[model samples]
Target: MEPQLLHGVADSVATVVIHHPAKRNAMTAGMWRALPPLLDVLAADPGVRALVLTGEGGTFCAGADISSLQGSPDEAQRLAQRAEEALAAFPKPTLAAVRGHCVGGGAQLAAACDLRFAEEGALFGVTPAKLGLVYPAAATRRLVTLVGPATAKYLLFSGELIDTPRALRTGLVDEVLPEGELGKRVAEFTRVLVSRSQLTQAAAKEFADGRTDRDAHWADQARGSGDPAEGVTAFLQRRGPRFTWTVPGPGSA
Candidate 1:
């Protein structure tokens, strides 16, 4: 069966599932091509507060489907990079709920997400070295940002799988849960994110992702949104803040 990227939304969280059980959810070129548009749709939805990327059949993605590598190699690489950039640039919080193997491009995708929650038995690796291919510079930089240069080199040079504990220690993963608890824990965390102010989250995500220099527009947004005042009032009143700031589009308010 062909690999697929499946998506759905519930309770303000969009779940994107990589499905290819036969190849351990390996991503095909077509799957890579499909991701950016799907992410665009989800990101444009004001009701969707967050996104979760995972794999079906109890396994996360294994990497690019090697068989497809024999054809349209450049297109595949380009699409894969586009997909990764889309995920990284997504305005809302994004999480990777990982299980089993997350290697090579799969590891790259997870690294693009804001947070990673892994099952205890999950394995991670960055394997371009094993394939005699160069890892993309942008992806390499993202990996370095997540796990530092030394650790990124360790994964890139060795192409060896690391367990969840090492992943957590290296900051590759935010949390590790037992086999049956990952979903519940991720859902709980997403609920907390949903309840928070989207304006604050968006600003923080942008600044945290290496946007060191702030522009005048950022300050304008903070003042215009009124989220800070609402947050403070809600805190004093011991209630949840009703944040009504929707994502701004091209010229829409």
Candidate 2:
């Protein structure tokens, strides 16, 4: 199939599938360009409480379609940076459901998500060093934040692939599932995410990302929201709380 990003939403979850199976889902320039706008649409949808990014098949992504970077490396790098930033800025929870290889730009995309779940035997790498490309500062900092300075340096300096165990140990992936169980775990976990209060999730996302100024704003919002009351009532009644809050606006948090 032609390289593209396939999108879908169901049960409050939006799934973006990177499809370039001809090259193990390597992203093309066009695919990189498409991500921000697609994410905008999903973010604006009230039905979308969370999102999952994954590859089309066994391989998560092999990196950029090298041809996309052939003529103008700067342009390709800029596209990737923008796409990565968009994912990081998404208002709701975002998860990267990964399998097989997730290297270079693929690793960047996965790192952008709030969480990453990989299958056993998956291989991951940060490979700009191999291409003699300077990784963007923001992406580098984000990677460092996820895996710590030492582990991040190891990956960036060597451009060598690491297995799922190493990725998990370094905190690069949140969970490592067994083979075919990745999809099941992802679906099960996202359902739990959707069942909870989006208000709490949105606020927590911003806070976890290091926004210290929003504490007051979130406090006021919590006071005004019914989620807290419902949560209490549900606990007393022994039932799931019916959370009614959605994000107040798009492109927030």
Candidate 3:
């Protein structure tokens, strides 16, 4: 079967499955290219309050399909960069439901999500060191932001696989579940998340996202954006805000 992104929805959560389990759900360049448009669909769909990214056949994702690494290195890097941008900037909340191996590009993909829920058996690593490949700076930044400089350095430098417990301790996985219960647990958690207000979530995501960069003008820009006004008004009235703001589309606008 052709490697494909399978889409399924459950109780307002959109699940994007990477379906190439024979290779441990390893992602190809085409699969990387496919993520952005799928994310766009999920973001625009009012019914999809949260998104789940997982892989088929127990394994979350092994990494890039190195078997197909015959392309121009520059082209591959460019495409991977674009895909990473889409995943990082996707509006609304995203959860990575992981199991088995999550290494290299697979780990990068999961790190791009807002939260990661992994089975106790899952493994995570940044394996560029092992493969003699350079990890992209943006992906490195995301990993650093999640686990801090010291932990990020250890993972990137060693290229060793860490178990689920170590991953949680390092803030790689937000939550861990027992083997068979991972799917059910992820579903329950996602449902609870979607029940909350999107406006609050969006603002929280924005604020938290900008926190890493320490943008000097973020305060004034945020206040002038009108989002805070709607937020305050909705809170005072005990009603939901009609959040009219939209993030910039993929690629330079």
Task: Please report the candidate that would top lDDT against the real structure.
Answer: 2
- Per-model CA lDDT versus the true structure: 0.90, 0.94, 0.83
Clashes of each: 0, 0, 0
Error of 2 at 251 (Å): 6.9
In the range 84-147, model 2's lDDT, one tens digit per residue, is 9999999999999999999999999999999999999999999999988999999999999999
What overall lDDT, based on C-alpha atoms, would model 2 receive against the true structure?
0.94
Output the lDDT of residue 81, model 3: 72
lDDT of 3 by residue, 120-171 (tens): 9899989878877788998999999999999899999999999999999989
TM-score of each prediction: 0.96, 0.97, 0.84
Model 1 residue-pair collision total: 0
How do all the candidates rank in terms of lDDT, highest first?
2, 1, 3
| Alpha carbon deviation, residue 93, candidate 3 (Å) | 0.2
Give per-residue CA lDDT, model 1, range 60-134, as digits (tens).
999999786556666667777899999998889999999999998899899999999999999999998897877
Cα deviation of 210, candidate 2, in Å: 1.0
Task: For model 1, name the residue pairs that clash.
Answer: none
- Measured with C-alpha atoms, the lDDT of residue 141 in candidate 1 is 95
**Model 1 worst lDDT window (10 residues):** 244-253
* Residue 100 local lDDT, model 2: 95
